[model samples]
Target: MAHTINDLVGTDIEQYLDQHEHKSMLRFITCGSVDDGKSTLIGRLLYDSKLVFSDHLSALEQDSKTVGTQGGALDFALLVDGLAAEREQGITIDVAYRFFSTERRKFIVADTPGHEQYTRNMVTGASTADAAVILIDARKGVLTQTRRHSYLVSLLGIRNIVVAVNKLDLVDYSPEVFDTIERDYREFAAGIGIEDFTCIPMSALRGDNITESSPSTPWYTGPSLIEHLETIEIADELSGRPFRLPVQWVNRPNLDFRGFAGQIAGGSVRPGDRIRILPSGLESTVDRIVTADGDLAEAVAGQSVTISLTDEVDVSRGDVLAAADEPPGSADQFECHLIWMSDQPMLAGRPYLIKLGTRTATATAATPKYKINVNTLEHTATRTLALNEIGVCNLNLDRQIPFDPYTASRDMGGFILIDRFTNATVAAGMLHFALRRADNVHWQAVEVNKRARARTKAQHPAVLWFTGLSGAGKSTIANLVEKRLHEQGFHTYLLDGDNVRHGLNKDLGFTDSDRVENIRRIAEVTRLMADAGLIVLASFISPFRAERQLARELLDDGEFIEIHVDAPLSVAESRDPKGLYAKARRGDLVHFTGIDSPYEPPESPELRLDTGGAESAATLADRVVEHLRTLGLLTPPPAG
Candidate 1:
């Protein structure tokens, strides 16, 4: 009997109830570059599973009436194309989630966007994925995007991979075509350290070799896509893994029940199991596991449940609960492989919002060790990263964070960076190793007293961060300020844009990641000077607000003063200090802030100086000196 909309809804509701009764489920993601047929493959998988209802079918049929390539035939891509823009673009822009069930297993599939620009979205979807399905368009074979997607999947440590080779019809279902692509990808996969790989061929549009056997490909012998998905053993892979559950919410209802609720990110948990809360490293035994349905004897990975611990220890959201036997290490510095996603480029020394598990922190890139050339898979000894570029970097967080190597565990290894002001996700990182372990072995402690050093040097160290448009008089005012401080018998160091480039930052270019590293190196140098009690005046077009804030955090609360050197675009262009504004106007620079890229001004600057309309460099310097006097850092010298 054909199931109607009403019957499907009733079955879904009953199944929802039944799911609460079960103790486990699996979550995975489908990822590839655009034109990989990810959406069509997912839609076909759901349709063949009989998970679609009459209403969904009718709606899709109705939606197809006004949309897509043809009339009458159902556009399966419409199933996952929930957004209007996605439909218009005919591409998956955001993460689309779908749920379905087979007789053997229940599954949640996150269909992630494939465009290189939306790599951050891919990270969000894959963050929770235990397995990943990477699609390859057989016609195009292994392209640059293919290698990039494979690198990211392996970097994120997705242990299981189903390499779905779509559009076999385009290649005449030639087994040789399939074998060549497979062998090429297999070699690429092995180089990146991915061991588990299953290659399958199918035409998502025609439904050939999707659910049932295809007689057209009698020469090819492999399980159908649906059959492989249904029978593949995932339980053993999860069972032996270490337990890690990041508490999302503390569910305390009416003062009667108090429990920590979160989805099990990895491993399993049972009643009376001993678990440790990370960052705190406090231990407790699980008292009971409760869901909305009832109590449970055990809860495994991917199950969302609330747990009560016997010893009421201090645990909250952002706290990770793990097996006491194998707790994640708390470290302040770690090495990572990052895919730069933002056009703004990652700034060195700039602070970014780091989200690991449920915890949020401020972190800075220590330095970029090297960038990998995607086409050749070779490490290019570069100092910075750009959009869609992959690099190995070291990060220094404000405090110690509990983390595991991505090779050891995906859940503990992956993290994302959010721009502080725009809140845009700028980068996705995979853990490689913690540098802190080696640091502790060869650690050195300086014996100089900071306060005494300031007194002896006759200056309080500071990082004067100047941000403005490209032609803004940031460098000009910074030079004058340094001159004034030098004459005032104060120990001062000036780090100007062009001067630093000629020396300390000579290797860096104007790309986003280069800018980030440029600011980072300058900030680190400023930090050292400040420790030695020298005022560090830094002048750069530090456009991003997040990067400025990161530089500020490296100093004392009042030590880092943001001086906004304000000037209208027209006025700055008239000055044309470096003739950069002309180049940016000429379309030579792709992401020049205030022209093509956005320059986020400081919302709450310590000082604002308009370098336009009769404001001289000396006057600006005097204004800065007055502000410093207000902070009790400087005074007039002997009333001369």
Candidate 2:
């Protein structure tokens, strides 16, 4: 009594259905141990979904017969891993992305590598994924890689975890083995603060319980992986946070129009919303929102728009436009989590460009205070960090920037550091919170800042730090430079080690710890003087490189110029201006540098004057002035 389509009324049902169906998309990743069938699983998903073309299927069948690991069965992994090298190695090396759609929802899956060395690639795959399909071999219940990936997914802010217990056919479809792994992983996930995870059983090779529930497992009662993926909802939390948009460009088409253009990183915005500018603290109201098609009434997170302001304020690139009533905290120091990705290790106080949102600033990271143990979840103290290491540390920037915590806004809170010389991306970081001191000690808003003061003085504020052995002519050269600057009508201040020890550092001793604190105080003082728009010259032995670097990090970009008075140790000892060197030769002083203690010379200094050679104090002072002129620090005053 049932009629076929030909006998019935329909002429083109396929075209009718295609015009009306609406499907949402979900992006997920497959990650597990090596040889755990991650790539194979993706290949199976493609073949079973009818996404593989007939021509590709013919090649796959022949390749499978010749060299496949499945005993003449089709090698499904070839569908995802297309590279010849990857196929020969029988492993997934890079992140293989595949796209397909079902009747209900479209899917984009990333098949990530399972080796330890490629763990960073896994992070790349999971960084933007909505769900993670972590494969686990039933024979090996739980592993270090499983835990490691789970921890990484949590760190990347992914909320969904689908544990696929693969290769169930290898265990004879035993419900007992499946239950044990499910229970063991549940406990582990709970311990690591991951509770929103699901577990399913399947064999990626035999096509059991992948798209359809396997008849062999009569005891299990859960939806297949595809069904679960199609139904679960991905809730976007960034859209609910406070409104913020980092200005990427200033659009000025003609005399009558100007606008700030950028993607909305957090919350929502519309006409009539009042906004505040960060670092400058200017206020304005949104007058209009323009899009490519037409004017929009409002736009939420992830939408790019050009916005006009009611007031003509000083807005520019690298500035964040935020809600006036709920502006983010602004500071130069923050404690954050960082993942090192470079071959060169992260060295303390080395300048790197940190790009957060649309803002970029010169930053220096302290040596990692502690590192997280990937397997045991223990925090261990460390002095050095290398590739694939995740650590917590403090970073100091050249100027204040605005941001929220990573938990509040992923788009605005994440940042990456780029190497200055190579321009390669070296690290990825997420802001946790601004140091409590950033809030406790707010920048005192004054009528004048360094730029205004510098204009009045006709020169920029800077610090010339001098370091060498005890009698390296550092003080002599610094004194001559200051005199030459004075003749040039420049204001300056000098902080000599002996003079500072007489008063400011009287309580400090020559021990290593005391020396560190002494330099710290001197750096703070130098920063204060620079803020007052006066050039500062600091002459110190500064036997340790770390302490000198600490001093450099306290100043603004291009504000600290290091001059190494490169006199040989013998030359310094022979021309000893201070009697301390002679006393140290008689064993009267214990920590006299170049005699009893070591002097770590600067690897690369801005100026290396050879007092041991023919360079005179006056000539060296002239060179210093010339370098300053080249840096634009000694330029003419700005015109009114």
Candidate 3:
């Protein structure tokens, strides 16, 4: 199947370089069910195209002989399945990327895994792909994974698709088999909004219908895989969209020059074009489009350049510089399609960090509108999304962000949800549109703000958060601390978990979702009390670190003090002050912390009081008061 490249052997090497450099690039992925020959097809494509170097070929041959599953025949799959575990298991586990070039086009093929558990890996590979080569094992026909991947490809906005019916040689190169598979895939594809796709018959191992037409099937007359890929029109429409350049860096070399640098995400820009700094609504004109090769008269999408503003406006990283008249929408809340990628199931009202383009903001996802059933393409009602699940959700961010609909521009519309505590990317999302309420809601200014309230009370307002397992003396110590502060003329209030549940949180239950909401409400209320210039003491068995962190972020730095009321499970259970542990042990109470649910102890707290030790609650409360005095929380009003 190996073919020679004329450019490699030609005397005009410089001419070849220029031709190769000018070729259009295509990014595509190989996907479908397991054992569909995705890796082998890409490897064989690389080999037949003469893109593999001789030294790499030698190592491939040696590796094939030692550990290949091809019975000593040239194992092409070995070329792309580079992971040790993947080779041992004879299955792809990660997304493997390979680059090759024909004379007409340069190609990047991502060999994504077919396992359901690794669906996130496939999404990562497909996120940037211009096309997709959905392979199917001829013997297996269409499968769940095949349908799932097809749905994902359409969801990701990849319109260019090729259904390569692989391993035809195993099925005796039957035309009937290819036709049936194509019919089934097409029927399924149409259900998921895929109106058009190309179908091909081939044996990736035998290299039939890959680089050239195979004699094994005279019934097949379509262009070869290489022929179609080389000529397929993956449209370049980004240049016609409204211009967007997310400022990645503020290039300030000296006092005289200040420029914003980033790759243009859409449309085109020139030196004299007007631009707007987004979320700020500040206008400026492009002064110079500077590049490494000096200044450019014009710059288009995908080109990285530094743009100086004619006006001295405050532009910074995470800000978008867009076409002035057609600036993108800015909103603090949006309706989005989300794909949960983490092993931990998504819980509503839990805070997460969302990163869109260069901007980052704290966000919380509401309960899903609905999750998609990949098999039937049906929508199912769900409270939370498990790994590999897709749902439509409303995300509320702390600040407004500039964005476009994902259909218009992927760079500005696509974002990832990151767990704030672990910093792991938990989900990928596509913004559909901003919520109408985001536009209507505005903060009204007040003459007596938080600072004024604090000044009137003669104290720096603060939230003393106490967290631990149930029956861990958090409320006991917090009450004592508040009493001691009140005696010294300091304004104070205590928000106890049980008392709040009796009234404010009466509707909330003990489910994980309810627990998150419970803490979220308490946090907002604590913020209000602190803003009123009161030293608010909140005592609760707030289990999750994420919710605790959320409460902390609501206040200014040093205004939120975390105090851990420490106690071993044995000690807390033995005390059984509320007899809650007994009910949990009897299986009467579900989702109880230290029984069914988990309690994430604070890794670092401002103060730790070991209730399991010999220290009395009053003594621990005294220690808390002393720590507060050191932080100046209990200091008297300063002299005028």
Winner by TM-score between candidate 2 and candidate 1: 1
* lDDT against true structure, model 2: 0.85
- Clash list (residue pairs), candidate 3: none
What order do candidates take by TM-score, descending?
3, 1, 2
Question: Given candidate 3, what's the lDDT at residue 51?
Answer: 75
- Superposed on all Cα atoms, model 1 deviates from the true structure by an RMSD in Å of 5.6
Off by over 4 Å in 3: 1-3, 7-9, 635-640
Would you list the C-alpha lDDT of every candidate in the order shown? 0.81, 0.85, 0.93
Better of 2 and 3 by TM-score: 3
lDDT of 2 by residue, 1-640 (tens): 0111231227677664563245577999999888789989988988888888899999899988876778889989888877887888898889989997666677889999988778878888887799999999999988998888887788877888899999999999999999999998888788778877888999989888888888988898898888889888978776888899999999999999999999999889989999999979999999999998999999999899999999999988989999999998888999999988787677665668999989999887876789888777888998556887889999988789988888787767888898865688888889998887766876578988887887888888999999888888889889999999998899999999989999999998885556656777798899999988899999998887766776787788899999998889888888877688889989999877888777888889888888789878789888988999999998755654
Candidate that beats the other on lDDT, 2 or 3, i.e. the better one: 3
Superposition error at 481 for model 2 (Å): 7.5
Poorest 10 consecutive residues by lDDT, candidate 2? 1-10
- Candidate 3 residue-wise lDDT, 497-565, digit = tens: 999999999999999999999999999999999989899999999999999999999998899999999
Q: What residue runs in model 2 are displaced by over 4 Å at the alpha carbon?
A: 1-21, 62-68, 236-239, 279-281, 324-326, 348-350, 366-369, 444-640
| Candidate 1 residue 31 C-alpha distance from true site, Å | 4.1
Query: Who wins the TM-score comparison?
Result: 3
